[model samples]
Target chain A: MNLVLRAACVYMALLFVFRVAGKRSLVTVTTFDFLLLLIISECTQQALLGQDYSVTGAIILVGTLVSLELGLSWLKCRSTRFERWLDGTPLVIIEDGRILRERLAWLSVDEEDILEAAHVQHGLLRLDQIRYAIVERNGAIAIIPWREGG
Target chain B: MVEIKRAGDLETSEDLAFERTSRRVRRVARSLLYVFVLLAALGLFGDGPLSHARAGHESGFFVRYERFARVDGTTRFQIHPHPGSSAAPRRLFVSTSLFERGHVEQFVPEPASVEIAADRSIITFPRVESGGFVVLVMRPLRPGALRFSLGEEGGPTLDLALFVYP
Candidate 1:
């Protein structure tokens, strides 16, 4: 029961923080980000497990975490709004070679970032070469190149 | 970027979209595994929060300590004896490389005298009543493995090892 409570709290806390931190934080990974992640996990483990290091305690913690995740996934699949809230709806940042500066600013994305993704993802060489640019749920910028004939 | 005019349908590509999300999840899982490996290597799961080893005598009077600790932090060391009044307080010499002897603090019940020395601290328990135990609170002076024993080095039954983090 304690394990379940701890897991639930940690899950909600992480969800809230990631949502508040926005998608860009998770999408962009630096060397320091990896180290920060490890530190956070270490602290979380201490809070979750307390001083109980038995095999049973370990099983309980794992069980609680997996169960909570499965429940959230089930909820997400059933409710579109819940899914949107859990994973923000993707935003279309560019359309027909026109940059949506407002939406791009909202996500703190830049023209350079978009161009970089465009070239790497779809061989788009310039802003005018892109037909559509969307910010995907996972935080990566997606580019749709202009049709050759169109 | 390769595209067709949304054709009046602006919905994202279902297949590629799903792949992107799954790839992200896979990356996250990999990162979690990496951290887990690090924690396991540090023996944190065994000695830190998940430690289930209680303070009890298996062969001789022993102490189970955190093999790893942080400098300037405190850890509890519990002691359980052989259910009787040992009139003579046990004279134990503590030798540690990881902890500063002057900075080491102790908290125990009555009838225990701790003598701080240059290389060791003598912890003597004077006829502790039944059900009474000794609890020592020690602070690390440096970051390394602090080794000590209740008696002579290598021959002491109550030997302990603590690693301090800087």
Candidate 2:
């Protein structure tokens, strides 16, 4: 009972914190961010396990966390509003050879980020060559290039 | 705002209105996160400058303890016994709740003898000058508010409470 309760509480707390931190924060991870993630996991492990070091305790905690994740996914599938709120929707940051400066600023994405995404995804050189750029729900930028004359 | 259309073959739901509101909410939440971290650093949630506290008159009978402590983490408290006649033994009394919740790990200036009772435990120390003190180290067994007391026998007993964080 203690194991399950601990797991559920930790899972909910982490989920809320990570969601509030914004998707862009983890999409591009620096070395420091990776170190921070490791430290966070270590702290979480101590809270979840407490003094129990048995195999059964570990199994129970894992099961509880997995079950909670599955339950949330099920709930997300049932409601589009919930899905949008939890996972967010794709945002169009660039449209018709123009960059949406306001949206870029809100997302902390600079012109350099868009250019890098454009260079890697499509060999496009200039912003004029790109027709649209969408920031996906998973925080990856997707670029669409203008095709030859119709 | 630019009008967004679902023109591509890729399956994606483009909701600029929701995205805008979500970003605003995210900004607000980020501000809250900053406050939370600041408070934690100041020891509002656990051990820090704010957690260290003292109670009672230090000149006579007093105690120094942490306002906040971690479960299973070692914490130390000092008790200054009131000065009495030179030949009289200095005795200190501790509430049994301290024994139950606070797993007493060590004691400095070991007591000459300890008498366990149903409500409280009486600790006797050899006769010493007035300014001397004793230190008790404890590892809390659980979280939540722990109420305890320490005082010289038949003298002023000080009641104290500390919160243990998990």
Cα lDDT tens digits, model 1, B70-165, are 555577666644445467565545564424432556656543676778766666666655555566667665656666654422334455666565
What are the per-model DockQ values? Answer: 0.04, 0.53
Candidate 2 Cα RMSD (Å)? 3.2
Off by over 4 Å in 1: B1-9, B12-166
Query: Which numbered prediction scores highest in TM-score against the true structure?
Result: 2
Output the worst ten-in-a-row residue range by lDDT, candidate 1 chain A.
A80-89
Candidate 2 TM-score, true structure as reference: 0.89
* lDDT of candidate 2 over B1-166, digit per residue (tens): 2224565543457877788788888889889989999988998766778888888986678898888888878888888777667578888889999988878988888879999988899888787666777898999888899999888778998889899976
**lDDT of each residue in A30-94, candidate 2, tens digit only:** 99999999999999999899889999999999999999989989988788788888888887788
Candidate 1 C-alpha RMSD relative to the actual structure: 14.8
